[model samples]
Target: MRLVVDLNRCQGYAQCAFLAPDVFAMHGEEGLLYTPEADEAQREKLAQAAAACPVQAILVDAVDPPAEAVSGER
Candidate 1:
Protein backbone atom coordinates (compact mmCIF):
# COMPACT_ATOMS: atom_id res chain seq x y z
CA MET A 1 0.00 0.00 0.00
CA ARG A 2 0.95 3.63 -0.43
CA LEU A 3 0.66 6.28 2.26
CA VAL A 4 1.30 9.98 2.14
CA VAL A 5 1.52 12.29 5.11
CA ASP A 6 1.06 15.99 4.46
CA LEU A 7 4.00 17.48 6.29
CA ASN A 8 2.52 20.94 6.01
CA ARG A 9 -0.59 19.79 7.83
CA CYS A 10 1.18 17.66 10.41
CA GLN A 11 1.58 19.02 13.87
CA GLY A 12 3.99 16.34 15.07
CA TYR A 13 1.36 14.89 17.39
CA ALA A 14 3.11 11.47 17.34
CA GLN A 15 -0.17 9.60 17.13
CA CYS A 16 1.00 8.02 13.90
CA ALA A 17 4.25 7.02 15.55
CA PHE A 18 2.39 5.42 18.42
CA LEU A 19 -0.04 3.65 16.16
CA ALA A 20 2.38 2.46 13.46
CA PRO A 21 5.95 2.68 14.54
CA ASP A 22 7.03 0.54 11.63
CA VAL A 23 5.78 3.03 9.07
CA PHE A 24 5.83 6.29 11.02
CA ALA A 25 8.48 7.92 13.15
CA MET A 26 9.15 11.18 14.93
CA HIS A 27 12.26 12.94 13.76
CA GLY A 28 14.59 14.91 15.98
CA GLU A 29 13.02 18.11 14.67
CA GLU A 30 9.66 16.81 15.94
CA GLY A 31 8.47 16.34 12.37
CA LEU A 32 7.36 12.96 11.07
CA LEU A 33 9.11 10.53 8.78
CA TYR A 34 7.14 7.75 7.14
CA THR A 35 7.22 5.15 4.44
CA PRO A 36 4.90 5.57 1.51
CA GLU A 37 4.68 1.86 0.88
CA ALA A 38 3.75 -0.16 3.92
CA ASP A 39 3.92 -3.95 4.04
CA GLU A 40 0.68 -5.87 3.97
CA ALA A 41 1.28 -7.06 7.52
CA GLN A 42 1.27 -3.47 8.70
CA ARG A 43 -2.07 -2.47 7.19
CA GLU A 44 -4.00 -2.56 10.45
CA LYS A 45 -1.42 -0.53 12.29
CA LEU A 46 -1.17 1.94 9.41
CA ALA A 47 -4.93 2.33 9.36
CA GLN A 48 -4.86 3.04 13.04
CA ALA A 49 -2.21 5.66 12.47
CA ALA A 50 -4.23 7.30 9.74
CA ALA A 51 -7.30 7.40 11.95
CA ALA A 52 -5.34 8.72 14.88
CA CYS A 53 -3.83 11.70 13.09
CA PRO A 54 -5.49 14.81 14.49
CA VAL A 55 -4.71 16.87 11.40
CA GLN A 56 -6.01 14.14 9.12
CA ALA A 57 -2.77 14.30 7.14
CA ILE A 58 -2.23 10.64 6.58
CA LEU A 59 -3.46 9.18 3.30
CA VAL A 60 -3.44 5.43 2.56
CA ASP A 61 -3.70 3.79 -0.83
CA ALA A 62 -3.81 0.10 -1.62
CA VAL A 63 -1.49 -1.01 -4.40
CA ASP A 64 -3.05 -4.38 -4.92
CA PRO A 65 -6.09 -6.41 -4.08
CA PRO A 66 -6.38 -7.14 -0.39
CA ALA A 67 -5.86 -10.70 0.77
CA GLU A 68 -9.43 -10.71 2.00
CA ALA A 69 -12.25 -9.39 -0.13
CA VAL A 70 -13.76 -6.05 0.85
CA SER A 71 -17.14 -6.13 2.62
CA GLY A 72 -19.04 -4.59 -0.29
CA GLU A 73 -17.76 -7.07 -2.84
CA ARG A 74 -18.71 -10.71 -3.50
Candidate 2:
Protein backbone atom coordinates (compact mmCIF):
# COMPACT_ATOMS: atom_id res chain seq x y z
CA MET A 1 0.00 0.00 0.00
CA ARG A 2 1.04 3.60 -0.53
CA LEU A 3 0.86 6.56 1.80
CA VAL A 4 1.29 10.32 1.78
CA VAL A 5 1.60 12.71 4.69
CA ASP A 6 0.79 16.36 4.16
CA LEU A 7 3.67 17.72 6.14
CA ASN A 8 2.57 21.27 5.55
CA ARG A 9 -0.67 20.62 7.39
CA CYS A 10 0.73 18.28 10.00
CA GLN A 11 1.03 19.57 13.54
CA GLY A 12 3.45 17.08 15.08
CA TYR A 13 0.71 15.43 17.14
CA ALA A 14 2.66 12.17 17.22
CA GLN A 15 -0.56 10.19 17.27
CA CYS A 16 0.37 8.57 13.98
CA ALA A 17 3.86 7.91 15.19
CA PHE A 18 2.49 6.17 18.24
CA LEU A 19 -0.11 4.25 16.29
CA ALA A 20 2.10 3.03 13.47
CA PRO A 21 5.70 3.05 14.49
CA ASP A 22 6.64 0.85 11.57
CA VAL A 23 5.40 3.42 9.08
CA PHE A 24 5.54 6.72 10.97
CA ALA A 25 7.99 8.39 13.31
CA MET A 26 8.80 11.67 15.03
CA HIS A 27 11.76 13.71 13.96
CA GLY A 28 13.79 16.14 16.08
CA GLU A 29 11.05 18.56 16.99
CA GLU A 30 8.02 19.02 14.73
CA GLY A 31 9.15 17.08 11.69
CA LEU A 32 7.73 13.66 10.90
CA LEU A 33 9.32 10.64 9.25
CA TYR A 34 7.38 7.97 7.42
CA THR A 35 7.48 5.34 4.74
CA PRO A 36 5.70 6.16 1.50
CA GLU A 37 5.00 2.50 0.81
CA ALA A 38 3.87 0.05 3.43
CA ASP A 39 3.16 -3.64 3.50
CA GLU A 40 -0.41 -4.75 2.94
CA ALA A 41 -0.30 -6.34 6.35
CA GLN A 42 -0.11 -2.89 7.85
CA ARG A 43 -3.37 -1.67 6.32
CA GLU A 44 -5.28 -1.63 9.59
CA LYS A 45 -2.48 0.16 11.36
CA LEU A 46 -2.22 2.64 8.52
CA ALA A 47 -5.91 3.36 8.79
CA GLN A 48 -5.62 3.91 12.50
CA ALA A 49 -2.65 6.18 12.04
CA ALA A 50 -4.39 8.16 9.35
CA ALA A 51 -7.40 8.59 11.55
CA ALA A 52 -5.31 9.54 14.53
CA CYS A 53 -3.66 12.42 12.72
CA PRO A 54 -5.09 15.50 14.44
CA VAL A 55 -4.77 17.56 11.28
CA GLN A 56 -6.00 14.81 8.98
CA ALA A 57 -2.79 15.09 7.00
CA ILE A 58 -2.26 11.46 6.20
CA LEU A 59 -3.49 10.10 2.86
CA VAL A 60 -3.04 6.40 2.62
CA ASP A 61 -3.35 4.63 -0.73
CA ALA A 62 -3.90 7.91 -2.54
CA VAL A 63 -0.33 9.06 -2.54
CA ASP A 64 -0.09 8.86 -6.35
CA PRO A 65 -2.34 11.25 -8.15
CA PRO A 66 -4.69 9.80 -10.73
CA ALA A 67 -3.61 9.87 -14.36
CA GLU A 68 -5.96 12.66 -15.33
CA ALA A 69 -5.20 14.61 -12.18
CA VAL A 70 -1.47 14.78 -12.71
CA SER A 71 -0.26 18.19 -13.95
CA GLY A 72 -3.93 19.12 -14.24
CA GLU A 73 -4.21 17.13 -17.47
CA ARG A 74 -7.42 15.68 -18.80
Candidate 3:
Protein backbone atom coordinates (compact mmCIF):
# COMPACT_ATOMS: atom_id res chain seq x y z
CA MET A 1 0.00 0.00 0.00
CA ARG A 2 0.97 3.64 -0.35
CA LEU A 3 1.17 6.42 2.15
CA VAL A 4 0.54 10.00 1.13
CA VAL A 5 0.84 13.17 3.17
CA ASP A 6 -0.69 16.49 2.24
CA LEU A 7 2.10 18.94 2.91
CA ASN A 8 -0.34 21.81 2.66
CA ARG A 9 -2.06 20.52 5.77
CA CYS A 10 1.09 19.52 7.66
CA GLN A 11 2.35 21.69 10.50
CA GLY A 12 5.67 19.89 11.16
CA TYR A 13 4.29 18.23 14.27
CA ALA A 14 6.47 15.14 13.65
CA GLN A 15 3.87 12.89 15.22
CA CYS A 16 4.12 10.64 12.20
CA ALA A 17 7.83 10.31 12.72
CA PHE A 18 7.31 9.22 16.29
CA LEU A 19 4.56 6.81 15.45
CA ALA A 20 6.02 5.25 12.32
CA PRO A 21 9.69 5.93 12.02
CA ASP A 22 10.01 3.20 9.44
CA VAL A 23 7.70 5.12 7.12
CA PHE A 24 7.92 8.77 8.17
CA ALA A 25 10.58 11.24 9.17
CA MET A 26 11.48 14.94 9.33
CA HIS A 27 13.67 16.63 6.79
CA GLY A 28 16.49 18.99 7.69
CA GLU A 29 14.13 21.95 8.13
CA GLU A 30 11.23 20.05 9.67
CA GLY A 31 9.58 19.21 6.38
CA LEU A 32 7.99 15.77 6.58
CA LEU A 33 9.46 12.94 4.57
CA TYR A 34 8.10 9.45 4.12
CA THR A 35 8.21 6.34 2.03
CA PRO A 36 5.35 6.17 -0.43
CA GLU A 37 5.15 2.38 -0.40
CA ALA A 38 5.30 0.46 2.85
CA ASP A 39 5.33 -3.24 3.70
CA GLU A 40 2.18 -4.84 5.06
CA ALA A 41 3.79 -5.26 8.46
CA GLN A 42 3.89 -1.49 8.81
CA ARG A 43 0.29 -0.80 7.82
CA GLU A 44 -1.15 -0.56 11.31
CA LYS A 45 1.63 1.73 12.45
CA LEU A 46 1.12 3.89 9.38
CA ALA A 47 -2.56 4.15 10.18
CA GLN A 48 -1.72 5.27 13.70
CA ALA A 49 0.64 7.89 12.35
CA ALA A 50 -1.99 9.18 9.97
CA ALA A 51 -4.49 9.49 12.77
CA ALA A 52 -1.94 11.15 15.05
CA CYS A 53 -1.22 14.00 12.65
CA PRO A 54 -2.46 17.14 14.33
CA VAL A 55 -3.42 18.71 11.03
CA GLN A 56 -4.50 15.38 9.55
CA ALA A 57 -1.96 15.60 6.78
CA ILE A 58 -1.18 11.92 6.50
CA LEU A 59 -3.14 9.73 4.08
CA VAL A 60 -2.97 6.00 3.49
CA ASP A 61 -4.18 3.90 0.59
CA ALA A 62 -6.47 1.05 1.49
CA VAL A 63 -4.57 -2.21 1.37
CA ASP A 64 -5.82 -5.35 -0.29
CA PRO A 65 -4.93 -8.77 1.04
CA PRO A 66 -2.65 -10.85 -1.09
CA ALA A 67 -4.33 -13.79 -2.83
CA GLU A 68 -2.39 -16.58 -1.16
CA ALA A 69 -2.53 -14.90 2.19
CA VAL A 70 -6.30 -14.62 1.96
CA SER A 71 -6.81 -18.31 1.15
CA GLY A 72 -7.37 -18.79 4.87
CA GLU A 73 -5.74 -22.19 5.13
CA ARG A 74 -5.05 -21.56 8.80
Candidate 4:
Protein backbone atom coordinates (compact mmCIF):
# COMPACT_ATOMS: atom_id res chain seq x y z
CA MET A 1 0.00 0.00 0.00
CA ARG A 2 0.99 3.61 -0.59
CA LEU A 3 -0.14 7.01 0.57
CA VAL A 4 0.47 10.67 -0.06
CA VAL A 5 -0.35 13.62 2.14
CA ASP A 6 -0.68 16.99 0.53
CA LEU A 7 1.16 19.22 2.95
CA ASN A 8 -0.27 22.30 1.34
CA ARG A 9 -3.81 21.08 1.94
CA CYS A 10 -3.05 19.73 5.38
CA GLN A 11 -4.23 21.76 8.36
CA GLY A 12 -2.39 19.83 11.08
CA TYR A 13 -5.61 18.42 12.44
CA ALA A 14 -3.75 15.25 13.54
CA GLN A 15 -6.70 13.07 12.56
CA CYS A 16 -4.56 10.85 10.37
CA ALA A 17 -1.85 10.64 13.00
CA PHE A 18 -4.38 9.70 15.62
CA LEU A 19 -6.03 7.10 13.42
CA ALA A 20 -2.91 5.59 11.86
CA PRO A 21 -0.12 6.16 14.31
CA ASP A 22 2.20 3.67 12.68
CA VAL A 23 1.94 5.29 9.30
CA PHE A 24 1.37 8.95 10.24
CA ALA A 25 2.67 11.11 13.03
CA MET A 26 3.23 14.63 14.13
CA HIS A 27 6.79 15.99 13.99
CA GLY A 28 6.80 18.91 16.38
CA GLU A 29 4.18 21.63 16.09
CA GLU A 30 2.46 21.72 12.69
CA GLY A 31 4.99 19.58 10.89
CA LEU A 32 3.58 16.20 9.82
CA LEU A 33 5.58 13.02 9.41
CA TYR A 34 4.54 9.84 7.65
CA THR A 35 5.64 6.81 5.69
CA PRO A 36 4.69 6.75 2.04
CA GLU A 37 4.80 2.99 1.64
CA ALA A 38 2.93 0.86 4.14
CA ASP A 39 2.18 -2.78 4.78
CA GLU A 40 -0.96 -4.35 3.32
CA ALA A 41 -2.19 -5.12 6.78
CA GLN A 42 -2.53 -1.40 7.38
CA ARG A 43 -5.08 -0.98 4.62
CA GLU A 44 -8.06 -0.64 6.93
CA LYS A 45 -6.25 1.75 9.24
CA LEU A 46 -4.99 3.71 6.26
CA ALA A 47 -8.51 3.99 4.85
CA GLN A 48 -9.84 5.18 8.18
CA ALA A 49 -7.02 7.67 8.44
CA ALA A 50 -7.71 9.05 5.00
CA ALA A 51 -11.40 9.37 5.74
CA ALA A 52 -10.69 11.05 9.05
CA CYS A 53 -8.60 13.81 7.51
CA PRO A 54 -10.53 17.03 8.09
CA VAL A 55 -8.66 18.65 5.27
CA GLN A 56 -8.72 15.51 3.13
CA ALA A 57 -4.98 15.74 2.68
CA ILE A 58 -4.31 12.05 2.92
CA LEU A 59 -4.60 9.90 -0.20
CA VAL A 60 -4.38 6.19 0.56
CA ASP A 61 -3.75 3.53 -2.10
CA ALA A 62 -4.11 6.14 -4.78
CA VAL A 63 -0.49 6.87 -5.46
CA ASP A 64 0.10 6.71 -9.17
CA PRO A 65 3.61 5.97 -10.25
CA PRO A 66 5.39 8.32 -12.57
CA ALA A 67 4.81 7.72 -16.26
CA GLU A 68 8.35 6.54 -16.82
CA ALA A 69 8.24 4.28 -13.83
CA VAL A 70 5.00 2.67 -14.96
CA SER A 71 6.23 2.27 -18.51
CA GLY A 72 9.58 0.91 -17.37
CA GLU A 73 11.38 3.51 -19.43
CA ARG A 74 13.76 4.59 -16.70
Candidate 5:
Protein backbone atom coordinates (compact mmCIF):
# COMPACT_ATOMS: atom_id res chain seq x y z
CA MET A 1 0.00 0.00 0.00
CA ARG A 2 1.04 3.57 -0.67
CA LEU A 3 0.19 6.78 1.10
CA VAL A 4 0.15 10.19 -0.51
CA VAL A 5 -0.21 13.49 1.28
CA ASP A 6 -0.85 16.68 -0.62
CA LEU A 7 1.26 19.23 1.16
CA ASN A 8 -0.40 21.97 -0.80
CA ARG A 9 -3.75 20.94 0.58
CA CYS A 10 -2.61 20.12 4.11
CA GLN A 11 -2.93 22.69 6.85
CA GLY A 12 -0.90 20.97 9.59
CA TYR A 13 -4.10 19.99 11.36
CA ALA A 14 -2.28 16.99 12.92
CA GLN A 15 -5.41 14.90 12.61
CA CYS A 16 -3.65 12.29 10.55
CA ALA A 17 -0.96 12.03 13.17
CA PHE A 18 -3.56 11.70 15.84
CA LEU A 19 -5.35 8.99 13.96
CA ALA A 20 -2.28 7.01 12.84
CA PRO A 21 0.93 8.00 14.49
CA ASP A 22 2.67 4.98 13.06
CA VAL A 23 2.11 6.17 9.51
CA PHE A 24 1.86 9.93 9.88
CA ALA A 25 3.42 12.68 11.98
CA MET A 26 3.92 16.40 12.34
CA HIS A 27 7.36 17.91 12.08
CA GLY A 28 7.63 20.76 14.52
CA GLU A 29 4.82 23.21 13.80
CA GLU A 30 4.95 23.71 10.06
CA GLY A 31 5.87 20.40 8.59
CA LEU A 32 4.16 17.06 8.10
CA LEU A 33 5.68 13.70 7.31
CA TYR A 34 4.23 10.32 6.39
CA THR A 35 5.23 6.94 5.13
CA PRO A 36 4.93 6.86 1.35
CA GLU A 37 5.00 3.09 1.35
CA ALA A 38 3.00 1.60 4.16
CA ASP A 39 2.53 -2.03 5.10
CA GLU A 40 -0.79 -3.80 4.57
CA ALA A 41 -1.21 -4.09 8.33
CA GLN A 42 -1.59 -0.34 8.44
CA ARG A 43 -4.53 -0.23 6.03
CA GLU A 44 -7.16 0.29 8.71
CA LYS A 45 -5.22 2.99 10.49
CA LEU A 46 -4.37 4.66 7.19
CA ALA A 47 -8.00 4.74 6.23
CA GLN A 48 -8.88 6.27 9.56
CA ALA A 49 -6.17 8.87 9.17
CA ALA A 50 -7.38 9.75 5.70
CA ALA A 51 -10.90 10.15 6.97
CA ALA A 52 -9.73 12.25 9.90
CA CYS A 53 -8.01 14.76 7.67
CA PRO A 54 -10.03 17.95 7.63
CA VAL A 55 -8.50 18.98 4.33
CA GLN A 56 -8.75 15.48 2.82
CA ALA A 57 -5.12 15.67 1.82
CA ILE A 58 -4.26 12.09 2.60
CA LEU A 59 -4.55 9.48 -0.15
CA VAL A 60 -4.27 5.76 0.39
CA ASP A 61 -3.68 3.46 -2.57
CA ALA A 62 -5.13 0.01 -2.47
CA VAL A 63 -2.64 -2.84 -2.53
CA ASP A 64 -3.28 -6.29 -3.85
CA PRO A 65 -3.06 -9.16 -1.44
CA PRO A 66 0.03 -11.30 -1.49
CA ALA A 67 0.16 -14.00 -4.14
CA GLU A 68 0.13 -16.74 -1.54
CA ALA A 69 -2.85 -15.21 0.21
CA VAL A 70 -4.68 -14.65 -3.05
CA SER A 71 -4.05 -18.23 -4.14
CA GLY A 72 -4.81 -19.63 -0.68
CA GLU A 73 -1.49 -21.38 -0.67
CA ARG A 74 -0.72 -20.76 2.98
Candidate 6:
Protein backbone atom coordinates (compact mmCIF):
# COMPACT_ATOMS: atom_id res chain seq x y z
CA MET A 1 0.00 0.00 0.00
CA ARG A 2 1.01 3.60 -0.49
CA LEU A 3 0.36 6.48 1.89
CA VAL A 4 0.13 10.11 0.85
CA VAL A 5 -0.32 13.00 3.25
CA ASP A 6 -1.12 16.49 1.95
CA LEU A 7 1.01 18.88 3.90
CA ASN A 8 -1.18 21.80 2.93
CA ARG A 9 -4.27 20.18 4.36
CA CYS A 10 -2.65 18.66 7.44
CA GLN A 11 -3.06 20.47 10.74
CA GLY A 12 -0.61 18.39 12.77
CA TYR A 13 -3.39 16.90 14.85
CA ALA A 14 -1.28 13.79 15.50
CA GLN A 15 -4.29 11.55 15.11
CA CYS A 16 -2.60 9.53 12.45
CA ALA A 17 0.43 9.10 14.62
CA PHE A 18 -1.73 8.04 17.50
CA LEU A 19 -3.58 5.53 15.40
CA ALA A 20 -0.65 4.19 13.46
CA PRO A 21 2.67 5.02 14.97
CA ASP A 22 4.49 2.56 12.75
CA VAL A 23 3.37 4.39 9.64
CA PHE A 24 2.95 8.00 10.75
CA ALA A 25 4.78 10.42 12.97
CA MET A 26 4.85 14.09 13.99
CA HIS A 27 8.09 15.95 13.47
CA GLY A 28 8.83 18.48 16.20
CA GLU A 29 5.84 20.78 16.50
CA GLU A 30 4.68 21.88 13.06
CA GLY A 31 5.86 19.09 10.83
CA LEU A 32 4.68 15.59 9.98
CA LEU A 33 6.44 12.59 8.59
CA TYR A 34 5.27 9.16 7.48
CA THR A 35 6.20 6.15 5.48
CA PRO A 36 5.13 6.31 1.86
CA GLU A 37 5.19 2.55 1.33
CA ALA A 38 3.72 0.23 3.92
CA ASP A 39 3.63 -3.52 4.34
CA GLU A 40 0.45 -5.50 3.78
CA ALA A 41 0.31 -6.25 7.48
CA GLN A 42 -0.11 -2.53 8.13
CA ARG A 43 -3.15 -2.13 5.87
CA GLU A 44 -5.68 -2.02 8.69
CA LYS A 45 -3.62 0.39 10.78
CA LEU A 46 -3.03 2.58 7.75
CA ALA A 47 -6.75 2.69 7.04
CA GLN A 48 -7.44 3.67 10.62
CA ALA A 49 -4.85 6.43 10.34
CA ALA A 50 -6.42 7.76 7.16
CA ALA A 51 -9.85 7.78 8.74
CA ALA A 52 -8.52 9.40 11.88
CA CYS A 53 -7.13 12.38 9.98
CA PRO A 54 -9.40 15.26 10.94
CA VAL A 55 -8.28 17.33 7.97
CA GLN A 56 -8.71 14.48 5.50
CA ALA A 57 -5.15 14.91 4.35
CA ILE A 58 -4.20 11.27 4.27
CA LEU A 59 -4.66 9.21 1.08
CA VAL A 60 -4.16 5.48 0.83
CA ASP A 61 -3.82 3.62 -2.46
CA ALA A 62 -3.34 -0.03 -3.17
CA VAL A 63 -0.03 -0.88 -4.71
CA ASP A 64 -0.15 -2.41 -8.15
CA PRO A 65 0.46 -6.12 -8.36
CA PRO A 66 3.87 -7.24 -9.49
CA ALA A 67 4.27 -8.15 -13.16
CA GLU A 68 4.93 -11.77 -12.27
CA ALA A 69 1.84 -11.94 -10.12
CA VAL A 70 -0.33 -10.32 -12.76
CA SER A 71 1.03 -12.65 -15.43
CA GLY A 72 0.75 -15.68 -13.17
CA GLU A 73 4.41 -16.45 -13.66
CA ARG A 74 6.58 -18.38 -11.18
Model 4: colliding residue pairs: none
Q: Candidate 3: which stretches are off by over 4 Å?
A: 63-74
| Local distance difference test, each candidate | 0.88, 0.88, 0.86, 0.87, 0.86, 0.88
Which of the numbered candidates is closest to the native, going by highest TM-score?
4
Give each model a TM-score: 0.80, 0.80, 0.80, 0.82, 0.80, 0.81
* Model 2: per-residue Cα lDDT over 1-74, one tens digit each: 88889889999999999899999989999889999989988989999999888899999865544566557544
What is the RMSD, in Å, between candidate 3 and the native fold over all Cα? Answer: 6.1
Q: How does model 2 fare in lDDT?
A: 0.88
What's each prediction's clash count?
0, 0, 0, 0, 0, 0
lDDT of 5 by residue, 1-74 (tens): 87789999999999888888998888999699898988878888889999989999987766553465556555
Candidate 5 has a TM-score of: 0.80
lDDT-based ranking: 1, 2, 6, 4, 3, 5
- Per residue, candidate 4 scores C-alpha lDDT tens digits across 1-74 of 87889999998999988888999999999899999998888888999999989988888756544455566555
Q: Which lDDT tens digits does candidate 6 get at residues 49-68?
A: 89888999998885564455
TM-score for candidate 1, please give it. 0.80
TM-score, structure 3 vs. true: 0.80
